[model samples]
Target: MEPVTTGLIYAAAMAAIATARPKWEPNRGNERQYVLRPADISPLSDFGIADAAVYPVSAAQFPSGVDRIVSELNGYGKFGGDWNGEGALAPTAESVKEAIDFIRAFPAGLALPSPTISVGGEIGFYWSSAAGYVDLQIESLGHASLYIRNRKTGQDRFDDDIDWRTVGRQWYQEKLSILQDPLQIAA
Candidate 1:
């Protein structure tokens, strides 16, 4: 074979190998782990509920509460209640424990269903203080914000879209069973 032809073949082979065996670097920030922050009442309250004592609150209350909880827990600075933003709310250790407690202890009279926590990704699940028996699950993947609506309607639906990055797919899969039952995990 001609020298130039041999060089071209070698280059083509290298290009093929590079494309076939792509290297994936670990996320330096390691965004998969859940971060917790101090509990705040203002945003929680303003998110729309006058009192959590009520069995069923409006859906409007959930976003604000979720934002506040995420902020208090993650300490990613202020979230501005923008669902599409990349920022997350990490709860303090104590607050995380408290949140787990509250969800587990949620009154039976309220008839709230157990929550499924989707960890290690842009999608997160949490109970709303505004609605005693209701939970808010937010999913943001830098494309759009998807809210899983579990109230008002009898079916779960995607309400909207927001932009964010998703991480920790493995954590979510492993913790699926545990997240389904806070009481069982707590016990």
Candidate 2:
């Protein structure tokens, strides 16, 4: 299916889910979101589907930025040699999947990060705030680089060959806090 069609379908499904379940509580303390209670007869349970599971879909599960990332990834995935008209290489399927997985793991509450495709066929997620910015570039599935700068402290840090697989939500929560609240001190 075309990427736009797929995205539309996903959006329609999410809309249906939201309509069936029209309750959204604030994030409060924890980043997780609960459905409160499932509709006894929502559209999701139609078509004779028995025992339709209504799992809690956290913001992290399908962050608001996922659509842009997926769209860019699909477009980039179809690129061939010289896709950029400058002899740029196409991103491998592995790299695309890696990028998807990494973004899918983002914790809830952080603002939507802008996504971009590099001439090197790599995917990057960037976040910026009044105080600083965080750049996460995915070279492949388990390999990438992270650059963070704090304008308040004039400190910069970069790490190579990062294994995002093991980085938990707490780690993202801490780093993304810079974007969430620049005035707050890093704990």
List TM-scores for all candidates, in order: 0.20, 0.58
For model 2, residues 35-126, the per-residue Cα lDDT tens digits are 54445434535565534345565665544445556667777788897888997878888888888777666554456577777888777889
**Off by more than 4 A, model 2:** 1-64, 180-187
Among the numbered candidates, top TM-score falls to 2
Off by over 4 Å in 1: 1-72, 75-117, 123-144, 148-153, 163-187
**For residue 42, what is the lDDT in candidate 1?**
35
Each prediction's Cα lDDT score?
0.36, 0.70
RMSD of 1: 24.0
lDDT of 2: 0.70
Error of 2 at 59 (Å): 16
